[model samples]
Target: AAARNQEKRMVADVKRKEQAVAERILENDEYAQVQEEIERQHRAYEKKFQDSLGRHASEERNRQILITKTTDKVDLIDTTGRGVRPFEPSQVTTIRDHSFGLGHNPRKSGKLLDDVIDMVRDKPE
Candidate 1:
Protein backbone atom coordinates (compact mmCIF):
# COMPACT_ATOMS: atom_id res chain seq x y z
CA ALA A 1 0.00 0.00 0.00
CA ALA A 2 2.86 2.39 0.79
CA ALA A 3 4.52 1.73 -2.57
CA ARG A 4 1.27 2.24 -4.49
CA ASN A 5 0.69 5.60 -2.78
CA GLN A 6 4.26 6.73 -3.65
CA GLU A 7 3.78 5.81 -7.33
CA LYS A 8 0.47 7.67 -7.45
CA ARG A 9 2.06 10.79 -5.97
CA MET A 10 4.87 10.69 -8.55
CA VAL A 11 2.37 10.41 -11.41
CA ALA A 12 0.35 13.38 -10.11
CA ASP A 13 3.50 15.51 -9.88
CA VAL A 14 4.52 14.65 -13.45
CA LYS A 15 1.03 15.56 -14.74
CA ARG A 16 1.21 18.95 -12.99
CA LYS A 17 4.60 19.69 -14.54
CA GLU A 18 3.32 18.71 -18.01
CA GLN A 19 0.30 20.97 -17.63
CA ALA A 20 2.55 23.91 -16.71
CA VAL A 21 4.78 23.27 -19.74
CA ALA A 22 1.74 23.14 -22.05
CA GLU A 23 0.41 26.44 -20.68
CA ARG A 24 3.80 28.10 -21.21
CA ILE A 25 3.97 26.86 -24.80
CA LEU A 26 0.45 28.22 -25.48
CA GLU A 27 1.37 31.63 -24.05
CA ASN A 28 4.53 31.78 -26.20
CA ASP A 29 2.52 30.93 -29.34
CA GLU A 30 -0.02 33.65 -28.54
CA TYR A 31 2.78 36.20 -28.08
CA ALA A 32 4.44 35.25 -31.37
CA GLN A 33 1.14 35.54 -33.27
CA VAL A 34 0.48 38.97 -31.78
CA GLN A 35 3.95 40.17 -32.86
CA GLU A 36 3.41 38.92 -36.41
CA GLU A 37 0.07 40.75 -36.62
CA ILE A 38 1.69 43.98 -35.46
CA GLU A 39 4.42 43.64 -38.10
CA ARG A 40 1.85 43.05 -40.87
CA GLN A 41 -0.13 46.15 -39.81
CA HIS A 42 3.01 48.27 -39.79
CA ARG A 43 3.97 47.10 -43.26
CA ALA A 44 0.49 47.82 -44.59
CA TYR A 45 0.50 51.32 -43.14
CA GLU A 46 3.93 52.07 -44.59
CA LYS A 47 2.88 50.95 -48.05
CA LYS A 48 -0.25 53.10 -47.88
CA PHE A 49 1.76 56.14 -46.84
CA GLN A 50 4.25 55.64 -49.64
CA ASP A 51 1.46 55.28 -52.20
CA SER A 52 -0.16 58.50 -51.03
CA LEU A 53 3.11 60.36 -51.28
CA GLY A 54 3.70 59.03 -54.81
CA ARG A 55 0.22 60.09 -55.90
CA HIS A 56 0.75 63.60 -54.56
CA ALA A 57 4.06 63.87 -56.34
CA SER A 58 2.48 62.79 -59.59
CA GLU A 59 -0.29 65.36 -59.18
CA GLU A 60 2.25 68.07 -58.49
CA ARG A 61 4.22 67.15 -61.58
CA ASN A 62 1.10 67.27 -63.74
CA ARG A 63 0.16 70.64 -62.29
CA GLN A 64 3.63 72.01 -63.01
CA ILE A 65 3.41 70.77 -66.62
CA LEU A 66 0.06 72.51 -67.02
CA ILE A 67 1.48 75.76 -65.68
CA THR A 68 4.47 75.56 -67.99
CA LYS A 69 2.26 74.93 -71.01
CA THR A 70 0.04 77.88 -70.11
CA THR A 71 3.05 80.14 -69.67
CA ASP A 72 4.49 79.02 -73.00
CA LYS A 73 1.22 79.77 -74.78
CA VAL A 74 1.10 83.23 -73.25
CA ASP A 75 4.68 83.94 -74.28
CA LEU A 76 3.96 82.76 -77.80
CA ILE A 77 0.96 85.12 -78.01
CA ASP A 78 3.09 88.01 -76.73
CA THR A 79 5.79 87.28 -79.32
CA THR A 80 3.21 87.11 -82.11
CA GLY A 81 1.80 90.45 -81.07
CA ARG A 82 5.27 91.97 -81.06
CA GLY A 83 5.85 90.71 -84.60
CA VAL A 84 2.72 92.55 -85.79
CA ARG A 85 3.68 95.89 -84.18
CA PRO A 86 6.09 97.19 -86.87
CA PHE A 87 3.39 97.10 -89.56
CA GLU A 88 1.17 99.52 -87.60
CA PRO A 89 3.68 102.40 -87.67
CA SER A 90 4.44 101.80 -91.36
CA GLN A 91 0.71 101.92 -92.23
CA VAL A 92 0.38 105.27 -90.43
CA THR A 93 3.33 106.67 -92.38
CA THR A 94 1.83 105.48 -95.70
CA ILE A 95 -1.42 107.27 -94.85
CA ARG A 96 0.43 110.46 -94.07
CA ASP A 97 2.50 110.29 -97.26
CA HIS A 98 -0.55 109.64 -99.39
CA SER A 99 -2.39 112.57 -97.86
CA PHE A 100 0.49 114.90 -98.75
CA GLY A 101 0.90 113.63 -102.34
CA LEU A 102 1.47 116.25 -105.08
CA GLY A 103 -1.65 115.43 -107.16
CA HIS A 104 -4.08 113.88 -104.68
CA ASN A 105 -7.69 113.31 -105.83
CA PRO A 106 -10.23 113.70 -103.04
CA ARG A 107 -12.26 110.58 -103.90
CA LYS A 108 -9.24 108.27 -104.28
CA SER A 109 -7.57 109.67 -101.13
CA GLY A 110 -10.76 109.21 -99.15
CA LYS A 111 -11.02 105.56 -100.24
CA LEU A 112 -7.39 104.88 -99.32
CA LEU A 113 -7.85 106.51 -95.92
CA ASP A 114 -10.92 104.42 -95.29
CA ASP A 115 -9.06 101.20 -96.12
CA VAL A 116 -6.21 102.11 -93.77
CA ILE A 117 -8.64 102.85 -90.96
CA ASP A 118 -10.35 99.53 -91.47
CA MET A 119 -7.02 97.68 -91.31
CA VAL A 120 -6.11 99.43 -88.06
CA ARG A 121 -9.52 98.66 -86.58
CA ASP A 122 -9.18 94.92 -87.39
CA LYS A 123 -5.96 94.59 -85.28
CA PRO A 124 -6.14 93.18 -81.72
CA GLU A 125 -5.19 95.30 -78.70
Candidate 2:
Protein backbone atom coordinates (compact mmCIF):
# COMPACT_ATOMS: atom_id res chain seq x y z
CA ALA A 1 0.00 0.00 0.00
CA ALA A 2 2.84 2.48 0.86
CA ALA A 3 4.57 1.75 -2.47
CA ARG A 4 1.40 2.51 -4.35
CA ASN A 5 1.02 5.86 -2.54
CA GLN A 6 4.63 6.79 -3.39
CA GLU A 7 4.08 6.10 -7.06
CA LYS A 8 0.97 8.29 -7.12
CA ARG A 9 2.85 11.17 -5.41
CA MET A 10 5.71 10.92 -7.94
CA VAL A 11 3.28 10.97 -10.88
CA ALA A 12 1.46 14.01 -9.49
CA ASP A 13 4.76 15.88 -9.00
CA VAL A 14 5.81 15.13 -12.57
CA LYS A 15 2.49 16.37 -13.93
CA ARG A 16 2.80 19.65 -11.91
CA LYS A 17 6.30 20.18 -13.28
CA GLU A 18 5.07 19.61 -16.81
CA GLN A 19 2.25 22.15 -16.35
CA ALA A 20 4.73 24.77 -15.07
CA VAL A 21 7.00 24.16 -18.06
CA ALA A 22 4.09 24.59 -20.47
CA GLU A 23 3.11 27.90 -18.80
CA ARG A 24 6.68 29.18 -19.09
CA ILE A 25 6.77 28.26 -22.81
CA LEU A 26 3.53 30.14 -23.39
CA GLU A 27 4.92 33.25 -21.65
CA ASN A 28 8.11 33.11 -23.73
CA ASP A 29 6.11 32.84 -26.96
CA GLU A 30 3.99 35.90 -25.97
CA TYR A 31 7.14 37.92 -25.23
CA ALA A 32 8.71 36.95 -28.56
CA GLN A 33 5.54 37.98 -30.46
CA VAL A 34 5.44 41.37 -28.75
CA GLN A 35 9.17 41.93 -29.54
CA GLU A 36 8.62 41.09 -33.21
CA GLU A 37 5.71 43.56 -33.45
CA ILE A 38 7.88 46.35 -31.97
CA GLU A 39 10.69 45.63 -34.47
CA ARG A 40 8.24 45.71 -37.37
CA GLN A 41 6.87 49.09 -36.30
CA HIS A 42 10.42 50.49 -36.00
CA ARG A 43 11.30 49.33 -39.53
CA ALA A 44 8.12 50.86 -40.97
CA TYR A 45 8.85 54.21 -39.32
CA GLU A 46 12.45 54.16 -40.59
CA LYS A 47 11.28 53.57 -44.18
CA LYS A 48 8.79 56.44 -44.00
CA PHE A 49 11.41 58.80 -42.64
CA GLN A 50 13.86 57.84 -45.41
CA ASP A 51 11.23 58.39 -48.10
CA SER A 52 10.37 61.82 -46.72
CA LEU A 53 14.05 62.75 -46.63
CA GLY A 54 14.50 61.69 -50.24
CA ARG A 55 11.52 63.81 -51.35
CA HIS A 56 12.89 66.86 -49.56
CA ALA A 57 16.30 66.35 -51.17
CA SER A 58 14.75 66.09 -54.62
CA GLU A 59 12.74 69.26 -54.06
CA GLU A 60 15.85 71.11 -52.92
CA ARG A 61 17.75 69.99 -56.03
CA ASN A 62 14.95 71.22 -58.31
CA ARG A 63 14.83 74.54 -56.53
CA GLN A 64 18.59 74.93 -57.00
CA ILE A 65 18.28 74.20 -60.74
CA LEU A 66 15.58 76.86 -61.15
CA ILE A 67 17.69 79.40 -59.27
CA THR A 68 20.69 78.66 -61.49
CA LYS A 69 18.63 79.01 -64.69
CA THR A 70 17.20 82.33 -63.55
CA THR A 71 20.64 83.63 -62.68
CA ASP A 72 21.97 82.58 -66.10
CA LYS A 73 19.11 84.39 -67.88
CA VAL A 74 19.75 87.52 -65.85
CA ASP A 75 23.46 87.38 -66.69
CA LEU A 76 22.74 86.91 -70.43
CA ILE A 77 20.38 89.89 -70.48
CA ASP A 78 22.93 92.05 -68.65
CA THR A 79 25.65 91.11 -71.12
CA THR A 80 23.48 91.60 -74.22
CA GLY A 81 22.19 95.07 -73.17
CA ARG A 82 18.98 94.38 -75.09
CA GLY A 83 15.90 95.98 -73.65
CA VAL A 84 13.31 98.69 -74.44
CA ARG A 85 14.92 101.81 -75.87
CA PRO A 86 13.40 105.22 -76.70
CA PHE A 87 12.29 105.60 -80.35
CA GLU A 88 14.54 108.14 -82.13
CA PRO A 89 14.83 109.18 -85.79
CA SER A 90 18.58 108.33 -85.68
CA GLN A 91 17.74 104.92 -84.16
CA VAL A 92 15.51 104.14 -87.20
CA THR A 93 18.43 104.59 -89.60
CA THR A 94 20.71 102.59 -87.26
CA ILE A 95 18.13 99.77 -87.14
CA ARG A 96 17.79 99.76 -90.92
CA ASP A 97 21.58 99.56 -91.26
CA HIS A 98 21.66 96.74 -88.65
CA SER A 99 18.96 94.83 -90.58
CA PHE A 100 21.05 95.16 -93.77
CA GLY A 101 24.16 94.10 -91.87
CA LEU A 102 22.42 90.93 -90.57
CA GLY A 103 22.24 89.60 -94.20
CA HIS A 104 26.06 89.39 -94.19
CA ASN A 105 26.46 87.52 -90.86
CA PRO A 106 23.25 86.05 -89.43
CA ARG A 107 25.19 84.50 -86.53
CA LYS A 108 26.40 87.92 -85.29
CA SER A 109 22.85 89.41 -84.96
CA GLY A 110 20.82 86.24 -84.38
CA LYS A 111 17.40 86.57 -82.61
CA LEU A 112 18.07 90.18 -81.62
CA LEU A 113 17.96 91.31 -85.27
CA ASP A 114 14.78 89.32 -85.84
CA ASP A 115 13.16 91.05 -82.86
CA VAL A 116 14.32 94.46 -84.18
CA ILE A 117 12.87 93.75 -87.64
CA ASP A 118 9.60 92.62 -86.07
CA MET A 119 9.41 95.83 -84.03
CA VAL A 120 10.07 97.97 -87.14
CA ARG A 121 7.38 96.14 -89.13
CA ASP A 122 4.87 96.48 -86.28
CA LYS A 123 5.49 100.25 -85.91
CA PRO A 124 2.45 102.56 -86.50
CA GLU A 125 2.76 104.41 -89.84
Candidate 3:
Protein backbone atom coordinates (compact mmCIF):
# COMPACT_ATOMS: atom_id res chain seq x y z
CA ALA A 1 0.00 0.00 0.00
CA ALA A 2 2.85 2.38 0.67
CA ALA A 3 4.47 1.62 -2.67
CA ARG A 4 1.22 2.30 -4.50
CA ASN A 5 0.91 5.69 -2.72
CA GLN A 6 4.45 6.57 -3.73
CA GLU A 7 3.70 5.69 -7.36
CA LYS A 8 0.65 7.97 -7.31
CA ARG A 9 2.63 10.90 -6.00
CA MET A 10 5.34 10.36 -8.62
CA VAL A 11 2.77 10.29 -11.42
CA ALA A 12 1.20 13.51 -10.14
CA ASP A 13 4.60 15.19 -10.08
CA VAL A 14 5.37 14.13 -13.63
CA LYS A 15 2.00 15.36 -14.86
CA ARG A 16 2.55 18.70 -13.14
CA LYS A 17 5.93 19.10 -14.82
CA GLU A 18 4.47 18.27 -18.20
CA GLN A 19 1.67 20.82 -17.72
CA ALA A 20 4.16 23.50 -16.73
CA VAL A 21 6.26 22.81 -19.82
CA ALA A 22 3.23 23.01 -22.08
CA GLU A 23 2.13 26.31 -20.52
CA ARG A 24 5.59 27.74 -21.06
CA ILE A 25 5.61 26.64 -24.72
CA LEU A 26 2.19 28.24 -25.26
CA GLU A 27 3.39 31.50 -23.74
CA ASN A 28 6.47 31.51 -25.94
CA ASP A 29 4.37 30.94 -29.06
CA GLU A 30 2.04 33.82 -28.09
CA TYR A 31 5.03 36.09 -27.62
CA ALA A 32 6.41 35.17 -31.04
CA GLN A 33 3.03 35.87 -32.64
CA VAL A 34 2.88 39.27 -30.98
CA GLN A 35 6.37 40.09 -32.21
CA GLU A 36 5.46 39.09 -35.75
CA GLU A 37 2.34 41.25 -35.67
CA ILE A 38 4.34 44.26 -34.49
CA GLU A 39 6.90 43.78 -37.24
CA ARG A 40 4.18 43.55 -39.87
CA GLN A 41 2.54 46.75 -38.61
CA HIS A 42 5.86 48.57 -38.66
CA ARG A 43 6.53 47.44 -42.21
CA ALA A 44 3.09 48.61 -43.32
CA TYR A 45 3.62 52.02 -41.72
CA GLU A 46 7.00 52.42 -43.36
CA LYS A 47 5.62 51.49 -46.76
CA LYS A 48 2.75 53.95 -46.40
CA PHE A 49 5.10 56.73 -45.35
CA GLN A 50 7.38 56.05 -48.30
CA ASP A 51 4.49 56.01 -50.72
CA SER A 52 3.19 59.33 -49.36
CA LEU A 53 6.62 60.86 -49.66
CA GLY A 54 6.93 59.69 -53.24
CA ARG A 55 3.53 61.16 -54.07
CA HIS A 56 4.44 64.48 -52.47
CA ALA A 57 7.71 64.61 -54.38
CA SER A 58 5.89 63.97 -57.61
CA GLU A 59 3.37 66.69 -56.81
CA GLU A 60 6.14 69.15 -56.01
CA ARG A 61 7.87 68.39 -59.27
CA ASN A 62 4.63 68.96 -61.15
CA ARG A 63 4.10 72.26 -59.34
CA GLN A 64 7.58 73.44 -60.20
CA ILE A 65 7.09 72.51 -63.82
CA LEU A 66 3.80 74.41 -63.88
CA ILE A 67 5.49 77.47 -62.41
CA THR A 68 8.26 77.31 -64.98
CA LYS A 69 5.78 77.05 -67.80
CA THR A 70 3.80 79.98 -66.45
CA THR A 71 6.94 82.08 -66.21
CA ASP A 72 7.90 81.23 -69.81
CA LYS A 73 4.41 82.13 -71.01
CA VAL A 74 4.65 85.51 -69.26
CA ASP A 75 8.01 86.19 -70.84
CA LEU A 76 6.66 85.36 -74.28
CA ILE A 77 3.67 87.67 -73.77
CA ASP A 78 5.90 90.52 -72.63
CA THR A 79 8.18 90.08 -75.61
CA THR A 80 5.21 90.06 -78.01
CA GLY A 81 3.74 93.18 -76.45
CA ARG A 82 7.05 94.98 -76.69
CA GLY A 83 7.43 93.97 -80.30
CA VAL A 84 3.93 95.17 -81.21
CA ARG A 85 3.86 98.37 -79.15
CA PRO A 86 7.12 99.47 -77.58
CA PHE A 87 7.12 101.39 -74.26
CA GLU A 88 9.19 104.61 -74.03
CA PRO A 89 10.76 105.48 -70.74
CA SER A 90 8.72 108.17 -69.00
CA GLN A 91 10.47 111.55 -68.94
CA VAL A 92 10.93 113.02 -65.49
CA THR A 93 8.60 116.05 -65.44
CA THR A 94 9.42 119.30 -63.63
CA ILE A 95 6.93 119.32 -60.75
CA ARG A 96 6.90 120.44 -57.13
CA ASP A 97 8.72 117.45 -55.59
CA HIS A 98 6.45 117.14 -52.59
CA SER A 99 7.62 113.58 -51.90
CA PHE A 100 11.27 114.72 -51.36
CA GLY A 101 10.58 116.13 -47.89
CA LEU A 102 7.21 114.53 -47.09
CA GLY A 103 6.85 110.77 -46.75
CA HIS A 104 3.69 110.79 -48.85
CA ASN A 105 3.97 110.98 -52.62
CA PRO A 106 1.45 111.34 -55.43
CA ARG A 107 -0.33 108.06 -56.08
CA LYS A 108 0.17 108.52 -59.85
CA SER A 109 3.94 108.64 -59.48
CA GLY A 110 6.61 106.17 -60.64
CA LYS A 111 5.85 103.59 -57.99
CA LEU A 112 2.16 103.52 -58.86
CA LEU A 113 3.04 103.33 -62.56
CA ASP A 114 5.21 100.30 -61.90
CA ASP A 115 2.47 98.69 -59.82
CA VAL A 116 -0.13 99.21 -62.55
CA ILE A 117 2.24 97.83 -65.16
CA ASP A 118 2.93 94.76 -63.00
CA MET A 119 -0.81 94.14 -62.49
CA VAL A 120 -1.67 94.53 -66.15
CA ARG A 121 1.25 92.37 -67.26
CA ASP A 122 0.51 89.58 -64.81
CA LYS A 123 -3.25 89.31 -65.39
CA PRO A 124 -4.65 87.23 -68.26
CA GLU A 125 -6.93 89.10 -70.66
Clashes counted in candidate 1 amount to 0
Candidate 2 regions exceeding 4 Å error are: 55-125
- The estimated TM-scores of all candidates read 0.43, 0.45, 0.44
Error of 3 at 14 (Å): 0.8
Give per-residue CA lDDT, model 1, range 13-82, as digits (tens). Answer: 9999999999999999999999999999999999987886897777876766544433122212233446
Q: Give per-residue lDDT, candidate 1, residue 31.
A: 100
Q: Judged by TM-score, which candidate is best?
A: 2
lDDT for each residue of candidate 2 in 28-95, tens digit (9 for 90 to 100): 99999999999999999999878868977778767665444331222122333355744333232214
Better of 1 and 3 by TM-score: 3
lDDT of 3 by residue, 3-122 (tens): 999999999999999999999999999999999999999999999878868977778767665444442222122434456565322212222333443555454456654443465577
Candidate scoring better on TM-score of 2 and 3: 2
lDDT of each: 0.61, 0.62, 0.61
Against the correct fold, how does model 1 do in TM-score?
0.43
